[model samples]
Structures are given as C-alpha cells and as structure tokens.
Target chain A: MKIRTSEYIITEVFHSLKRNSWMAFASVGTVAVSLFVFGMFLIIVMNMNRMAVSLESQVEISVYLEDRLTDSEIKAIDKKINEMNGVNSVTFTDKIKALDIFKERLGDQKFLLDAIEGENPLPNSFTVKVVNPSLVKTTAIAINDFEGVETVKYGQDVVEHLFDITRLIRLFGIVLMILLAGATLFIISNTIRLTVFARRTEVAIMKYVGATDWFIRWPFMLEGIVLGAMGGTVAFIALRIAYNMIVAKIYDTIAFFPLIPTYPFMTYISIIIVCCGIVIGAVGSVISLKRFLKA
Target chain B: MIEMKDISKVYENGVVALDHINVSIDKGEFVFIVGASGAGKSTFIRLLFREVLPSSGALIVNGQDVVNMEHGDVPYLRRGLGVIFQDFRLLPDKTVFENVAFAMQVIEAPRRRIQHSVNSVLDIVGLREKYSCFPSQLSGGEQQRVAIARAIVNSPALVIADEPTGNLDPDTSWEIMDIFKKINGGGTTIVMATHDKEIVDIMKKRVIAIEDGHIVRDEAQGAYGYEN
Candidate 1:
C-alpha cells in the first residue's frame, strides 16, 4: 500500500543481503581490493605526471661562452638566443660568477677553487629555458651554431631519457587502470551473480505475480550500489590515512623532494574512487541480472 | 475469459509439446485439466501465463492477444491472474504474512490495503496463527495453502493452479480443494491441472483430458476417467 520507494527498496536489499551475508561480504571485499589498487595506481600516476611536468618545464639549455668574446658580442648572442622561437628566457653567467657557483657547489672543496680563482678558466654561459621540452634538442642545436657560443651543453642524454621514461610511465598507468577496472567489474558481478542465483525462485515468483522488471531489479541494484559505494568509501579512507603517513615519513626524510600534497589531492582521489565504486556496482548488478530479466 | 486458436509449441530440441491445440475457458467456471505425465498439461498452463509463448497462433486471455503482447506488458497481464505451483514456490526466507503481502506489494497495493487484504486472506486459508512462520516451519499441506493464499491475495479474476495439491496427502488434498471451492464461489474463474483422481471424481467438476498433445475428452461434470 503506497509504500515509500526507498523504504521498500532498502528493506528488500537488506533482506537479500542478510540471506547472502557471506557472499555480500566477498563481493564487497573484491570491489574494495580492486578499487584500492586502482585508486593507488591513479594517485601514483597523477603525482608522477605532475612531477614530470614540473621537471620538463624547468629544463634549461646551457651554452658556455668563449672567454675572448667582447661584452657587446655576448649581449648580442643573449638577445639572439632569447629571440629564438621556443626560448622562454635567457640568463647570462659570467666566468667569475660561474666560479663562485662552482665553489659553493664544492662545499668543502672551496680551497681547490681558490687556487685557480685569479686565473679562472671557467667560461661564461647563457642558460636557456625552453617553452616546450620536446623542442629542446632543436633549440640547443640552433644556439650552438651561434657565432660566439663555445659549446651547447644541456645534459642532452639525461633529459631525453627522462622525457621518454615519463611518457612510458603515463601510458602504462592508463592501460593498467583500464584493465583493473574491467577486472573489478567482472569480479563484482560474478559475486553478485552467486547471490542473485540463490534467490532466483523469489525473482521468478515476483515475475509470476506481475511485479515489473524494475520492481524486481530495484532491490538487487540497490544492494550492489550500496556494497560498491561502501567498498569505495572504505578504500578511500584507508588510502587517505596511508598516504598521509607515507607522505609525512617521506617529507621528514627528504625535505626538498616535490610531491603533490596530501590534502587537495586526496579530496580529488576520494571523488574518483566513490564515483567508480557506484558506477561499477550498478554495472555489475545489471550484467549479472541480464539472464533473469528476460522474463 | 481465455481463448486459444491453433496454438502450437515446439521445443528447440525437436519435442512437440503442444500441437495445433484450440480451447476456450469461460468466466466464473471451475475446470480441471487432467492428463498423464508429459501430456502437455504444463505447456498448456504455461501458455496461459505467457511464460512460454506458443510457436504459432493466437492466445487471447482477458481480451488481450498474449502472442503479440509487448514484453513489458506481460507482468501487467499476469497481475490479472493468480498462479500456484505443485511445489508451493514460497520464498523460504520470508514468513507467511510477508509471503502473501509480497503479492500485493508487487502490484503496488497501498500499505494499509495490503495489510488488511493479507490478514483477511490468511484468515480464509486458516493460516492466521502462522503469519510469522517461515515456509520451512509449515507442513506440505500448509505450505500449499500459503501458496494459495499468496496467489489469491491480489484478488485476480482468474486463478490457475498447476497441481496445487500434488505434494499433499489425500486428506490434506481435500482441504486444499475446499479452499478452491470457496474461491470459485466468489465468482473467480479457476483452471486447475491435476492428477488427483479421488479428488477429481468427488468434486464432479468439468474435466478436459489431454493425451500426447491433443484433447481426447471434454465433458461437463466428468470424472478423472483414467484407469491407471
């Protein structure tokens, strides 16, 4: 009689769940574990991408200047390099300034740099920041052909390898995430199928008594959705705590390393995990019930 | 009212379950369909409910062509009918009250109306005291009664019982027949398929006999008419 929609569905869902409590737990656990792994990979992939982008943007091409160049000629080279298509900025480092940086970098070896300080053989250099990392090699070659430039040294091998590795990591992460989602859907639905199969007679009776397809479907769908959302929520909370602890430990040990901070990123991670959980749960129920719905 | 014209059903495995059958069932009548094992009794009943569509010809139940009915409307068509099985397909997990109440819930009957109708029907079936008892707690006879209660709870114009007393003892079978008599008295058409000769001979209802996918006899107030 005029039953409230949610009340009826929730009662049915709870009844079915109670009848198949063990199977429900298994389904939820499967969804949770799969979702957890998927979520972990997503966060890793996101952070790695951020780190890669930051590193790429900071890639600088260093052009060591000849010691015999006049001041005006060096300035002209600076302007020319700056005017190149993809160069964002050009900063000049004179020989004395370069030696000072060398001394600072050597820390305990400052006395060795002091022996050659007056007769410094270090060359002046122009450090160039490129707008796009993929064009760094071309920009470096163009700058090398400049009249006064002695050598164009840009950690070429290391930078190219870093870009390649980051690209591969991103592609691998996407493929792995898709596979994990497919696997999660399969496991969740199979688990749900066990429960649905057990109660098939009830479903048949409902059909026999004139219950609409949706009327029969609502309870099972609700059960799947509730289980999935719960699994996702549990995984999200666990990830948050684990991520925070790990980040705290890492930051404590390595203060200068860049990481996407816990607070904002976790907020996004929670949304993604919960959404996936609900969608996967609904999809699983639908897939499992396909045979039964024919009647 | 129910009518069938040239209805035929052929299974995928080459078994001809129902072959070119035609029959009509009038309103407010009690008819018994009696047959031997594998005599197409089950297929005939299944055709009425649209559970298995006939391979050919028209089936009109309640003025709608079941053969051409939309898949979505099958459930609605079923709402006008009450069906009971030999095994008393009750939800073992639910109590008697919930079992009967589930029928009304499926049709979206109001809450108070469901409670009222379920209680009244349970009283009719003499299961008022066992409202909270699960199917496992009830005897075979009582479980069949509960199944009857569930079927009739929605007050359909037609009740189709397929061997409603198949699992009950003769004495209990009489008790189930008494309930069917009471329901028929209320002006509801009933088509029952059974092999219970003693009950069929005593009730003196109109009997239609089928053998090997064909109707052999159709008589008024006939006996079971089988020597075996």
Candidate 2:
C-alpha cells in the first residue's frame, strides 16, 4: 500500500462515482431511507425500554395497618419489615399525613372530604420499596400475613400487564431490527451490483492488465464506504430533526411522559446508525463484487 | 516463454475446446494463432494467460506453472504478460494517458516511473500528442493503439492479443499490425489470434492453425491457407 497506490484508489473511487452519478445518487438515497427507518425504530425501542424501567422502579408495596394499633405495635411492624430481605426503604405515613396528601391531591375539591374530616378515616400505612421491583408481589403477600397488617395492595394486575407489554415491545423491537437490517443489506447490495455490472467490462480489462483482486476491489470498497457514510449522515440529521420535534410535542402535551432525553441518547443512536451504515455498505460492496472478481 | 504438454480442455457442457495439444514457444518469438470461429483459438490465448485451465496438462507460461500455480499467484503471472482484445477495452472515461498509466498503477509502480513509462509507451503507439484524448474521441485504430500502449507499458515479456484488429477497417487494421511488428521487433514475444488472412500472410511470422480442438498446421512464414 504505497501512498501512490492509495492515491490511485481514491481517484478511481471518485472517478467512478462521478461517472455513474445517477447510480450513486440512487444508492445514497436508498441507504438513507433504510437507515432512517432503522434509526427511528432504534429510538422508539430505547425510549420504551427506559419507560418500562422507570415504571418498574416506581413499583412498591403498601401495607395498611389495622385500626387501634398502638405506636409500639406500628414500631414492631416497621422493625420486622426492615429485617426482611429485599426491602430498600419503609416510610410510615400516619393517617393525619395521608389526609393532608389527599386534601392536596383533591385541590379545590377538598370540600368533598369535609364530611369525614373529624373522624380521620384514612388508615396509617407503610410504603415499602424493594431492591428489585419483581419481588413486589412476594413481599406484599408476606407482609399481609403480619398480625397488625389489615391489607396489602401493590396494583398487582396492572403491574403484571405492564410487564407483559414491555416484554412484547422489547421482543418486537429486536425482531423488527433484524428484519430491517437484512432488507437494508439486500437493497444496498443490489444497488452496488448495478454499478458493478455497468462497469463489468472495465473490471475485465483491469483483470487482463494484471490488476490484483484487491487492486480492483479497493475503489469499489471505498465507494461503498463513501456512500454509506453519506447515507448515515443524512439519516442521522433526519432522525435528529424528527426526534426533536416529537420530543417537543410530547413535552408540550404530556410533560411527565418518560421519554429519554435528546442529548447523548440521540448522539449514541446516531453513532450506531452511521457505523451500521458503514458496515452494511462495505459488506454490500464485497457481496456485489464477488462474481465480477472471478476474472 | 510458454510450454503446453498433453493439454486438453473439456467444457462442462462437454465441448472440447482444445485437445491433447503440445506446443513450446520460446522467448521473443512472434507467433499468430489462427483459426475459424469456435476453433479453439480463443481458448489457446486464454490458456497462455492462465485465464482458462486445461482439463489435464502441464502448462508453463513465463517460467510459472499455469496449472498448479496458486490462485494468489495468478496476478503475478498475468503481470509478466500483456493481453489485448478485439474490443480495445479502454475505459471510456479515461484519457489515453490515464488508460496507459493504469497498468503501471495496478502494480503500484512509483509515480515518477509510471509517468515516464506511460509517456514512452504512448510515444511508441504514436499517440503521445493525444494523451489527453478519451477513447470515444479516438478512431478505431487509435483506440487500439492506446490499448496496445496500455498492454506494453509494463514491459511484459510476452503480449497476448485476441483479434486486435477485428473491429478496424483494412487500412486501420494494418496500422494496428505495424505497432505489433514494432513491438515484436523490440524482443517482446507476441501471440495473436486472428482471422485476418491478408495480414497473417503478409507478416510471414510463425503461424499455428487450429481446427476442431487440434492444431492442424504449424509453420514458419506461413500463408493464410484457409479459403474463407
């Protein structure tokens, strides 16, 4: 690989690209479209995973106490829960604090609770967080058996359904990614094959004139890289713009929606997409050049 | 520069291209391989460059074993030989200079040496002044001359051509042949396959004629014996 040969290969790459400008344009467009779709799905799947994780972390058990429990009895229950495995934290909310929270949540409708205000009907409960969200059910059931505990609730059915949906999303994302990647490779290679086919006689001439396989392949490989890089850049820019608009819109409508932040997350996605584009481009060139290089 | 012993070529569809042939060509000998269509002339030229392997034979071209040579070494073997074809397969977009310089570039020759050798070969082909002219801008004969310049730029010991003048008029054909004679006079062995009887008879070089997969005649200073 002398400097001169490298120069020659670079020149040849640009020369062929210029000669077949239309084909090059078509190739770049196809790569961009394919990679854009890939990047879109990548963003969606990543944000879904993030949301699922955040939701899982929010899962906790609530143990309501039986009426007339003394301070010492509540203390005993708290110490027992502390000794249990997988308990991250236990915060006891007294009925008075619960009532205050309910009043705040009711906002202007606090008048609706005026009838029961003096009785202090809200029960004292411990909000329990576990080290692992998946253990919420088992921990809640165990706490329900305690002498002072009246009931345990942790949105059991809702949590189960959420887990199921998130699992399905992850599985579907993986399958979709694989299919899109395969399709991208196929399309890019076919486009490259047309370019190679057009210049097949040129390749034959090179072979007859003693050009080594690599000598002939270098230009095409470089062409693929160039096209891939261009396409990746295009897709990255498009994804960036589209993601920004969507993020802004979601924040405007649903501020608390757990969408992944746009900065480094998108940066990472762009890098992955561009790198995949490059790899796909190189592989496509190799595949397309295989039959022609037999000379 | 080439030796073939007990060579035979049976295509997969069972067409016998060359059969039980034995021939030896020494260095610097100008020979013409002449035959009718489908008479194995193309296969003979292809075998010299190791483009096609004989079904069973020992082939030595330019001191390299053609049949047993490793795949990686094929390019090295081809490097020592120049090959031309009837279509004058020049890159339509490349200038005459670049087209000739391309051969040297393929072998990764030094930049200065490529520039110098390409100029010299273009000079030999009498296209030095047309160095910047593209293939589409050249006449048939001039395009073939450019092809010759490219083939010889690397100073291959042997030049193999198949129908070098097939696409040109009679005068243009003769013009292409004059370049071949000039090249051959410079001690480069040339093996050309052609159907041009006039040039074959006039050149009076050693001729090998093939018919139906076998060489029917081998003569020095031979005439174009076929009526067609």
Candidate 3:
C-alpha cells in the first residue's frame, strides 16, 4: 500500500544480500547448472532429430509403369502425383535405357547377361523423391492403387524406424524438461528459504509494524529473480562454450551432417535461459515466503 | 480515543488470557497496564494494535471498529499506534538513521520528508552523532532509546511500550522512562506495560492492574499494585 515505504524493504533486502554474497552466489550457481543441463539436452536432442531426417532423405522410391501406357498418360500420372503434394521430383527411366544399365552392371557375369537377354523383364520406372521420407509409406500406398503402376519400392522399414525414434525423442525431451524445471524450482526455493530463515526476525518485525504482504514479499522475490538471472547468465555462457565444442567435434568427424545455426540457436537459448532463471527465482521466492508472511 | 468493551481472550486449552475487559482512554492520556507475569498485560497491549484478536467484544481505535475490521484494515489500525518491544528489534544490517527512518518509510513519506523526520527523531533520542552505527555497536540503553525513536518517528497518536526497559539497568530504566514521559508530554498517549515498582511509583501515572486475566484495580494516579 505504501509505495515509497516499500523502498525501505528493497534497501534492506539488498543490504542483506550484499552481506551474504557468497551464499547467494552459491544458490544461483546451483540453479544455473540445473538449467544448463536441461537446455543442453533440448538442443542436442533437436539436432539429433534433424540429423536423422537428413539421413532419411538419401533414400528414393521408384515405381515401374506398364509399357502399354501412352506417353501422355505417363506424363499425366507424374503430374498428378507431383500435384498430390509431398512429391519433390519425378524422373522417367525408359525401359530400353534401364535394360542397357542392367546389361552394363551384369556384363562380367555370363549367366546374368544370358538371363536378362532371354527375358527382358526390366521395365521403365519413375524415380520419385519425396519432400519427407516419413510420408513415403502413404505415397507408396497411393501409387500402388494408381492405374498402370507395377510396384512401389523404397527403404520403408528404415524410414518407419527413424520416424518412431524421432517421436520417442520428442516425448522424452518434453518429460525431461518438465522434470528439470521442477528440480530447478526446488533447489532455488530451498536456497532462497535459507536466506529467508536468516531474516525471519526482520520479516516478523516488519509485518507486526504494519507492513503489507506484498511490501514484505517483493524484495525477497526480486532477490530470487536476481539470483536466478545471474545463474542463468552463467549457464548461458557455459552452454555456448559447450555447444561450440560439441559442434566442432561433430563437424570434424561427421562432416556430412547439418549443424544448427550458431547465432539463432544462441539467441533462442539465451531467451529461454533468462526466462527460466526469472521463473525459477520468482517461484522459489514465493515458496520460501509463503509460511513466514502469513497473517 | 480508544474503546474496549468486554474484550475476552481464551486459549484453546482454556487458559484465559483476558476476561471481559471493559475500558476506554481519551486522547493524550498517559496510562500504564501493570501486573505480574501471565497477568495479560502483553495480551491487553496486543489487543489495541490488533495483533491478537479478542475472543469476544467490541474494540475501537481512532473510530474504527477493530472487532469487525478486515485483515487489510489491520495495518491502518497499526498506523495510528507505535508499539515497542523489550528487544530493540532494529534491523541488524541498517544504520541507526536507516532504522529510525523505517517507520516513515512504511507509510510512504516523501524522501526529503523522510530524511528531515529521521534527523529530527534521532536528535530527540540524542543519537544524531551515531546516525551510522548499527544496533550491535550501540549500548543497551542507546539501543532502547533508538527503539523508542523508531516507534515515535511517524508521529503516531498512541505509543505502546511493552517493558521498554525490561533489559536496562536502574539508571538506564530511568533514562528510558524519562524519554517516554517526554514523549507523552508532547501529546502522544502512552500505554506502557512495566512492573518496575520504583519507576511506576516515581512517575505516578494512571495504572490499571490485571490479576489473572481480570482488572482488579483502576486508579487515576496509581502505582505497581499486583504484589505477585
């Protein structure tokens, strides 16, 4: 209720914080470590998923068409499949050209060459590259039902497993974040509680002397926020260092994989870290002050 | 002015602290609540500030019906009163000036006004030279005086001193009582709780004696009279 009067609470809180800088810093440090691990896990999991999708893109599905189909009908079906969505590119392989490729591959084997010469079983197929490998199964089902299409073939099992793994990773990431956040709040609140306990006498006197609840609660809450933010900053720096180290190792060994953009990832991670710090700190202060501020 | 009508406080275990207390005091009247330990002196003081709600009855301070007052209004009741404890209760981290300024700060006084008022209160308590000293650094007597200064810094209408000199020696007790008398003379009503028979006899103020949760005696000019 007393705006100017609450300044006294702020002044007193800061004075107490200054007196116990080591303790305050230690508490904040604990929060930072917890949040850092959480953020690091999220970033790594996301990158791993991206890497999986990138690897799955290398497999392509090819559907063979009946030789009786006209050139116009073949072009129409290709256009229709492309227009149906998720189809990236469709290239036509002529039956004669496919036979020539097969002959060249089996030219050293006399029996394979003789069998291919006698049967001429190889047919013209459309090599279809989809936008997402995970959609290949549905695309194959649609292609199999289409007129004049012989069969749809791709690494379906590998794609299915990759999708399953990505889903599990996402689910685990969410659960892990919730648990980490809860732990962060617990540790920070306990830390702030110790500080609150030290000044329980001061809080009691202030309350008895007519200090409003919020007036008594604000400075401690702010103290928690400051501690959280400080810890978050430390965590941010550690994460960036860790990110760079890990990214460099991955680039050195697995040069084929796509790495996350450093600048954007850092920016997002920083915001997340700061927000986590503030929330944890605020929650901690509220938890710590609940009992002591009772009327 | 303050009024109390049959205010009673009974603990859950049936140890009655105050029993059907009816009393009233006009503006600027200095009074004392004197009794032995467990005689409800502290309970009576706490009642006026709304620190402990009476079990039953109507209590009014500054025209506000404290019995039916909401929790939000308790601070308003306390604003018009200044309560001091035996323990100084000064923030250990704050300087003497800051400690005294806290009363004004709680009521949201302007910064310039706060500085001026704190300086004046510290001067009244004779601690202007030790404005920056922490409570631990001050003497017991000086600390009590600072506590007194903090209590009256906001110019409250009524001052409650609960054994203000409980921890001081005889000389220091007299010094502290002198400060209270001076404060009362300045038109702030005082209801001090003390069992110091010598101080009570010398001061000759209106004394109300509480014996086992009952007001046994009320005198216009009374002394410490419970006799244990």
Candidate 4:
C-alpha cells in the first residue's frame, strides 16, 4: 500500500485509458445512455404514481336518500353516513337545494325546470368523501345497504381500470430498470475487455515475474470504476437538466399533474443511479478479469 | 534448490513432453538445459515455475512441495523466481526504469529501496543512461538487458531463463549471458534453457541435456555437448 505503488497503478490505468480513448469513450457512452433511460423512467414513474394517488384521493361517492323523509329524519341519515368507516366528510342536500343545483347546472334549460314549478322531483342526497379512495367502492356499497339510502355511485368502473393500468405501468418500469442495469454491465465489461485483451501480454509478464494476482488486477479494476462513475455522473447531469426543463413545461401548460417535488427526492434518486454505476463498474471489471486472474 | 524424483508430463493430445525426468539442482548452482525443438526443455522450464503440473512425480522447488501445491500458492512460489522469456517480454509503453520498477512495485517494495535497487541493477546491466528509454527505442540487446534488470529487481533466489537469447544476435547474447553469470555468481541459482551452442560451449557451466523426454546427461562444469 505504498503511496508510490498506488500512484503507479493510477497512472497506469489513466495511461491505458488514454491509449484506448476510442473504446473508453464507447464504454462511457453506452453506460450513460442506458443509465439516462433508467433515470428518466424512474422519474416519470414517480410522478405518474403520485398523480394517480392524488386523483384517487379526490373521488367522492354520492348516496341518494329515500324520498318522503322529514328534516329530522334527513339529519339522522346524514349523521349516520358521516359516522361510517372511511368517510372523511358528508354533506346533505335536500330536494329544494337539489332543485336549485339542477337549475344552475342547466342554465339555458330554466324553462324545463319551470314546467314542474310547484313539484320538486329531485332526490335529497349525501355526498361522502373517503380517507382512502381505494375503499370508496366498498364504503359506497355499505351505505347503499342502509335503510334511508336508495343508490350509491363513485365512478366505479373508471377508477378500477385506472388502478389496474397504473399497477401494470409500475411493473413494467421495474423490469425495464433491471434489464438496463444488466445491459450496462455487459457493455462496460466488454469494452474494458478490449483494453484488457490488448495487454494480456503484460499480464502474462507480470504472472511470470511473480506478481500476485491482485497486484495485476488492481489497475484494471480502478480503470473500470472510474469509467463507470464517469458515465453515471454524465447521466445524472443529463437527467437533471432534462427533468427540470420538462417539469417547467408541464407546470406552465397543465399544472394539475402531480410531480414529486425536486428536492430530497431527486437527491436520493441521483445517489441510487450513481451507486448503480459504481457497482456495475466494479462487477464488470471483476468478471472480465476472472479468467485471467485464475492461477 | 530443486528436486525432481520422477517427473512426467503427458498432454491431452497424447504427446509426451517429458518422461521419468529425474534430476537434482542444488542451491546457487548455475544449470543449463540444452535440447532441440520438442526435446522437453520448455516443459521442464515451465514445470519449475508451476506453469504446468507434473502428470506424475515428486517435484519440489526452494523447499516447497510444488507437485501437490494448490493453484493459489503458485504465485508465491513464482515470487521466489526471476523468470525471463525468449520474447524479452518488456512492457512496450513503459520506460526501462518503470519496467524494472514494476517488479518491485508488484511486491510492494518501498520507494527509496526500489529506487536504490533498480538503479544498481541498471548499473549491473550497464543500462544506467537508458532508464528513460522505451522498449522500442532500445536495440534488441538493450531490451533484453532491460528484461534481465526487471527479472532480478525483486532479488529472487532463483532465476529461470527460457531461451533468453533466442532472439538476440551473437554479441548481444554474450552480453546477456555475462549479466546472468554475474547474477549467478552473486549466490542466485540460475536455471537457463537454451540452444545457443556457441555461447554455451564458451561458458563452461553445469549442463543438463534432454532428448526425447529423457535426461541424457547431467554434467558439472560441462559444455553445450549436443549437436543439432
């Protein structure tokens, strides 16, 4: 572990990289491209999943009450729905107010409402929002079974399909990330292999001269790690710049899309990507040297 | 020191490279193995460095049982050896100093000591002024000399040269031989395999001759006593 020896190894690694600059660039480029896609996919998945959760949370169920109920009876039913499990809030609207809402909803059709002027046909209802949107359907069904409830609806079909698609997309993102990691390792090692193959004679010479296997392996491993880190850094910077631009554009046009705010979340993601790069680099170098290092 | 009671090697293709080769080389002895092509010289040299295992025999080098040694122990066994090759296997891009310095670096020698020993070895090979020269910049003889300096830099007890002068001219071969003699006289055991008859005939050392996988002769103070 002499400083001089370490310096020699570092210089040797850098020299070899300089000598095979073309292959070195190719290795870095491959790593950068693969990791860039992986980072982008991760960012997008984070935002999409957050957006889905937000949309799910905003869903509310409407329970139309049985007709001919008095004010006290309606109050009693409103209190019952509010006390139900998972119900965040419940607001009761009587037939008179329902009629007013109908009139507002049909601004140009006020004459149609005047035709039934003396008789109010709208049903009084309770609009209930739940803590967890996923439990909305079950809570609605439970309320529908209540004595004063006539019907319950919460955009049942559309919400179910949305959840399924989000789950599929999450699964796909995980698989793609794993595949990209493998591809990065393969390319980095193969590219470094060309450099190692070129100097196999040096390895043979070192072997014959009684240099230990690790002694011969250190410089090559160092080279690969540096190459991998370089690729990771490049990919991280590219992802950050591109992500900031897209996030700005998305906010300016359609601000409702729920994005993971760029702060600690981005910092954590960058660390993960860079660490992957380093690990891939180390593993690739070790794998490529396995055959040659065998005594 | 080296001992081979009954060493034999058979390739997978059924070629018998060496057969029942029994010989003993003592410590600090300079032995030359002379043979024609396919006469088992290379195999014998390789066996000393544990480059290949013996098919059947008891082989020991420097008091270590080499025949039954595991794969991981081979490098340690080699560390006691200074191996030179026919190709002058110098790193093409490293300067002569770095090439020699590399040996000590592999063994983790301190910088001051490495500097001192490398300089002295370069002086021994008479290449002190050519330390900064690359392999391509040096002539064949000078490069072989650089190879020799690298081999001895680690201060190994035994030096194995497999056709060290195979690619050198007559004068350069003599110069390389002179360095080996100097190294051997300094108490390092030298086992060199070569077919350079003129130089071997001139330098009367202990010569061991192999023919058809058998040791035909093991003579002390002997000449290269074989004809092509």
Best of the candidates, DockQ: 2
What is every candidate's C-alpha DockQ against the true complex, given to 2 decimals? 0.64, 0.67, 0.47, 0.60
Candidate with better DockQ, 1 vs 3: 1
DockQ of 3: 0.47
Q: Taking chain A by itself, what TM-score does each prediction score?
A: 0.79, 0.81, 0.86, 0.80
Models 1 onward score TM values of 0.85, 0.88, 0.87, 0.85
lDDT, model 4? 0.87
Q: Which residue pairs in candidate 3 collide? A: A5-B105
**Tens digit of lDDT per residue, candidate 2, span A178-289?**
9999999999999999999999988888888888898888899889999998899999999999999999999999999999899889899889989988998898998999
The top-ranked prediction according to lDDT is: 2
For candidate 1, write residues A1-295 as lDDT tens digits. 2456567888889877887888888888888888988898898888888888888887889999888999999999988987899888888888889988988899997888666648988999988999888888999998899998889988888898889988998998889899989988998899888888988898899999999888888888889898899889988988898888878998999997788898788999999998899989888998888899795
Q: Write the per-residue lDDT of candidate 4 for residues B164-215, one digit (tens) a residue.
A: 9999999889989999999999999999999999988888889999999999
Give one digit per residue, the lDDT tens place, for model 2 in B96-121: 99899888888999989999999999
Q: True contacts preserved, each candidate?
A: 0.82, 0.77, 0.52, 0.66
Docking verdict class for candidate 4? medium
Ten contiguous residues minimizing lDDT sum, candidate 3 chain A:
A110-119
How badly does each model clash, as a count of residue pairs? 4, 0, 1, 0
- Model 3 stretches astray by more than 4 angstroms: A1-14, A48-62, A93-117, A120-123, A127-147, A150-165, A257-261, B10-15
Comparing 2 and 4 by TM-score, which wins?
2
Second chain TM-score for model 2: 0.99
Question: In model 2 chain A, where is the ten-residue run with the lowest total lDDT?
Answer: A113-122
